[model samples]
Target: MAKQYSRPSHYEQLMKKLQNDFPGSEPITGLMLIYLKHIVHVVETSSDMIVKIVEDLHNMEQEETSCVAKSKILIISHDIHTRLYQQWSSRTLDIVEHGIEAFDTNETFENLIVDLLTQLLKLAVFLMKQPKLNLKNAMDALHEKVPDLLPQQSVVHYLLEENDSSMSTPSEFLTLYQRPFDTSLESDMVWPIPTRLFPYN
Candidate 1:
């Protein structure tokens, strides 16, 4: 006699458990976390591009070479901008608004952005072997474009230029590094989030 084949009910049970655990908020929370990770990645990548630009500026020993490098930097900047916009738009407002709330809307996200920028600045210093980029101007531009990107108490204000020194070490920016944040912040609230940061606005 042929052995009897048993239908697998294990998967069905597991699926039921997952649905119960998630309840009603898991999908939104999951998507938000994914978007947040991409956002940070994009910002970090863009910051590195700026560092590369600074490096090109310093490495240019001749006017002709400098122009070439500048052209390269411009091209890279344009490319970075395109990438950033694409990623930013793909993220839903529900995720960002929740993130803002999850971070306490105080300065968590702001600090994150500044820390990334500071790292890029330090990388620029090493790659260029000199301080060719104006850190202040770049920061100022960032602030103008994205207000409050750095927390007031964060090191961004004094990382590049302090009262006693003109340049700080890369270690200063490292302080921003934190363990992965909680993805499922509010597991109970199920509502539509308003417009968070409208890129078009």
Candidate 2:
């Protein structure tokens, strides 16, 4: 679906339809970005309109096709209380040069999305920071931004990796695989009250 929306004709078609349907002449203020399948859509509308826009998008997809990949809201990467880029606009991603599939720098999918975001925001900043929603201009804008940007903060920043070493023992990452502790009921209440830590017990 991301690839489908990347094409100029398809992109334009959707944007045009959205504009006509909603009929907003307002400059984009808020973003509801949903990332899936290597695509992050930072939908630029007011906060109120975001859910509507998302619903509309899904409806359009369902109308055309017959299935939906994911539901309306999953903030893959966002700080909802804060808007990261003031100068950024909608619909500016160069999937080719900044190829997502080729984004194999030992990062997780969640982190890769953030990396893509860095490139996108930097691109918006590069273009003297304005919304240029034309085709060649959008493409041109994307390419220009790519050369100047780097991954500002990658997933590596957060994770505590140990010396490129491999572990022999099984990870304790999962807390439980057994029945936490076995429970037995001899009677409704045991005669010699066994020790229990919490009052809830």
How far in Å is the alpha carbon of 28 misplaced in model 1?
A: 32
lDDT of 2 by residue, 1-201 (tens): 122332334434555565566765533343222122223345445543444445445554455462333232223233445444453234433333324333335656456545656765664455434454643474354435454453322222222121222211012211222226767778536777877767883
Which number leads on TM-score? 2
> What value does the lDDT take at residue 30 in candidate 2?
31
Q: Each model's TM-score, in the order given? A: 0.17, 0.40
TM-score of 2: 0.40
RMSD, candidate 1, Å: 25.6
Clashes by residue pair, model 1: none
lDDT of 1 by residue, 81-159 (tens): 2221111111211222222322323444346444655654443333233233643344334434333432222232222
**What is the Å distance of residue 67 in model 1 from its true position?**
16
Candidate with best lDDT = 2
